[model samples]
Target chain A: MTGPHGYSKDKDAHLKRLRRIEGQIRGLQRMVEEDVYCIDILTQVSASTKALQSFALQLLEEHLRHCVAHAVERGGPEVDAKVAEATAAIARLLRT
Target chain B: MTGPHGYSKDKDAHLKRLRRIEGQIRGLQRMVEEDVYCIDILTQVSASTKALQSFALQLLEEHLRHCVAHAVERGGPEVDAKVAEATAAIARLLRT
Candidate 1:
């Protein structure tokens, strides 16, 4: 695999955010298992959902900067395909 | 930027799937704008959510087979970090 370039520093920060989100999920699972208040569990679930949407958005932005931009510079249908794909992903994201 | 290797064929397929999902999202938007039945909108939204989850799972599996596995063969903390990141991403996906 080619080594990823261009965002190692920010990648680390993204990883840290993901780790915290991981912990939140675990806590959520325990909440469900323990039969915690339905509303309380739902609240945490909502927060986690938003957290994930935020992360996905961040990754999407980075993809545009790094992957899609590069593909466009090289020139071809690949660029249009990628932009369309990304737009679709964003549409999916907004639905949630 | 480096060209992506190992999944060009599948990548195209993924892009096509995303494009279809994009149309689905647009249809959902129209449904919302037209004030379609609440339950019907909710049902479509749920299907879209599952569709996104499926796409994410496919990408995650491919990443494990390609990226994470290659990083492991190369040897070092990079693999571990990647695996941790992937696990966290999976956790977030499940919460949804």
Candidate 2:
């Protein structure tokens, strides 16, 4: 299902964060092109990874607060399914 | 310390991957802009995160195969320091 989903409320903020991350990724490319130190590049990679994770966490929080909460209020099998889906997504985040 | 590190050998490949990741991040921005589903966005985030980690692993492999190995071949406290530094980087990767 497409959206206007749970994260729609923070869409601007999320887009801004993603753009910043995009810039960071571009910076890494420049580092590679310029032959920057490996350790420094690796450090930047870590920072980028962390930024992606942080963004995911924010979106997930909103999903739980909105989508999952609504499903829970309805009190049906869909609630269980929504919760499970959310959990699986969290697992994916952790695995990375 | 910069310019022509171990990863320089694969500089083109690394730059290619980083550029792809930058594209992915931009895709994410478009997704957010279009208001794609929360779960779908999260999935993309995981993919991007995995891609970053994969790039990092490749870099680390080269670093160990060349830089760290060189330090060990030198036979001194430099070897120990290099290993420690590498281990610390690994730790940072894990925590993220």
Candidate 3:
């Protein structure tokens, strides 16, 4: 909901990663279709989940380096808001 | 890889869920393309992660209900192997 977000500069790379993860999800579908072993499917799920966490971490790093830091430089309540937001995001990630 | 695996009976449902998740991944790509807020994107990532976990949970349920149960009924070392295999899978899921 914001323009030129922290990840905007790397949008293409982000899309590429998302697409690759999408492919992994499709691979999981195929594994199910072919009746692959349960453990094998579970392993793929974990891989996809791990890939997603990595993407989140990267986005978070950029957010802190850019958006959050920018908020701090602006010298207002925005910095607190950004830090709280990032913390919430991190908590959601950890729970997942 | 083994079939008819525990999930084979519900193959269609599993495939459908995975396709939905794939769509979510595509949605994430669109968000990045549109330069959505970093936190918003992170929220969606958590959602996708949660969905994957749900799918894994369902698969595990079927695995325990069918595969593990079958193994137990057969009354061999298979029961031990299946239980151990499932425990390992759960550990992996927890780590993710």
- Candidate closest to the true structure, highest DockQ: 2
Given candidate 1, what's the lDDT at residue A83?
A: 55
Pick by TM-score: which candidate is best?
2
Worst 10 residues of 3 chain A by lDDT: A1-10
lDDT of 1 by residue, B49-85 (tens): 7788778766755554456545655666775466557
Worst 10 residues of 1 chain B by lDDT: B1-10
Q: What residue runs in model 3 are displaced by over 4 Å at the alpha carbon? A: none
**Model with the higher DockQ, candidate 2 or 3:** 2
Cα distance off (Å), candidate 2, residue A44: 0.6
Deviation of model 1 at A8, angstroms? 32
Model 2 CAPRI quality:
high
Winner by lDDT between candidate 2 and candidate 1: 2
Better of 1 and 3 by lDDT: 3
> Candidate 1 has which clashing residue pairs, if any?
none
For every candidate in turn, the CA RMSD to the true structure comes to 12.4, 1.0, 1.1
The 10-residue segment with the lowest total lDDT in model 1 chain A: A1-10
Interface RMSD values, listed in order for every candidate:
11.9, 0.9, 1.1
Better of 1 and 2 by TM-score: 2
